[model samples]
Target: MSLDALTFRPATLADTDAVVALVESAYRGDSGRRGWTTESDLLDGRRTGADEIHAVLAKPQNMILLAELDDGSGPRLLACAHIAIEDGAGYFGMFSVDPGLQNGGIGKRVLAQAERVVREQWQTPTMRMTVINVREELIQYYVRRGYLRTGRFKPFPYGDARFGLPKRDDLSFEVLEKSL
Candidate 1:
């Protein structure tokens, strides 16, 4: 799909299932393998579930920004990301683009929009996100987009199936930040 044809909107509780499916497809399981963002090699199980999306939507300061394409049938979901304002900064996470649509500049556009919303709407000075430390290629992708590796790390929730099951023992998250 063309970037010019996409529309951005804040997701509601009604979008929980679709959002979860999109995220899982982009980050975990065999479906994710079709995209460059897949973590299948390092992790196993769901990237996100309906309950998580519902919780994010229920929060006042959180939003799941969705990118949709109106392809005549209806507005089809193409990408999504979770953004929340906390501690005077925007926290970005759960980013995913349609697996088949990866590497087509859609993610870049969605990220830029999220930053704009955080800066203009939330008046935040910085945007922050955490990536699995082992995802070197993913980290570099964000670096090229102006995100700096902060070297601040957090241990992955190994016992929490909500995050995912680690295929290997070495798993942690490194924080990345950018001035908005």
Candidate 2:
């Protein structure tokens, strides 16, 4: 499907499973390896879970944005991202695009829509995210999208199985931000 054919909508509780699957396929395991955004080499196990997504959905200031394409068939969940109002800025995370459809410009659209959701809907002035510092390619992708590296860092949770099991010891996150 063309980029114009994609649909953007806020995810509800009913969309939990599809959202989790889409995220896992894009970031972890063998499924994630099919996509350039995969962090399979850096981490292992689940990318996200129902409880976490449910928490995000339950919050009044947070939402999971889904990007779908209805190509004669029923709508297919192609991509998704988590947006939350942290302090005064929009925090973006849990971004995922179907591994099979990566590099097809779907991710770019989802990100743009996410920024719009925060800027227009929430009246937020800035968008921010944390990226695994080792993922240079992924970091560069966001840089090209206008995100600036803040030089600030957050230590990756080593004991948090919910995030993932790190394959290396030097894992950490770098902050990135953009004005809306």
Candidate 3:
């Protein structure tokens, strides 16, 4: 599909339900397992709920960009990229793509749009994100997308039930960055 068919914009409170469904389908449960993006082995339960999303939209430093695509079938939310500015740099997180479209070039297109927004709007020199240290495959995937590992690690929230119960003891996040 042409990139022109995708409209990128800041997500609103109204998009919460569809966004939640899209995220769950992309990262959790059996449906997520159909694609390489699933974190089913690492955690369970909801990813980001309506409340969390609303907070992001309310935050001055954060904005979640949703990618709505017009396929012949209908208006499909093909992907989402959550960008937050922290300590002067744009931090990209909670990104998800439709499982069936994983191998397609759509993800790169969506990411390109996100980076453009951050660089052009935030005017930041770098964009950063964290990946679970144990998820080497996912980390490598980001590496292939121009993100470089920084060797910076943050402890995963172990008791934060909102995030989910950890399946492994050594779970932590490795920081990655891409220069804008």
Whose TM-score is greatest here? 2
The better-scoring model by lDDT among 1 and 3 is 1
The alpha-carbon deviation from the true structure for residue 87 of candidate 1, after best TM-score superposition, in angstroms, is 2.5
In candidate 3, stretches whose alpha carbon ends up further than 4 angstroms from where it belongs are 1-3, 72-74
Task: Quote the positional error of residue 166 for candidate 1 in Å.
Answer: 0.4
In terms of TM-score, which candidate is stronger, 1 or 3?
A: 1
Worst 10 residues of 2 by lDDT: 1-10
Clashing pairs in 2: none
Cα lDDT tens digits, model 3, 1-180, are 676787888888988888888888998999999889898898987777888888889999688888888777777798997898997888888889999888887778778887888899878889999998988988998899889999899999998977766778899999999998
Task: Quote the lDDT for 56 in model 1.
Answer: 91
Q: Which lDDT tens digits does candidate 1 get at residues 1-180?
A: 567889999998888889988998999888899999999998887788888988898998899999999988999999999999977789999999999999999999999999999999988989999999999999999999999999799999998988888999998999999998
Name the better of 1 and 2 by TM-score: 2
Q: Name the top lDDT candidate.
A: 2
Candidate 2: where are CA atoms >4 Å away?
Answer: none
Please list the C-alpha lDDT of all candidates, in the order they appear. 0.93, 0.93, 0.86
Best of the two (2, 3) by lDDT: 2
Model 1: clashing residue pairs?
none
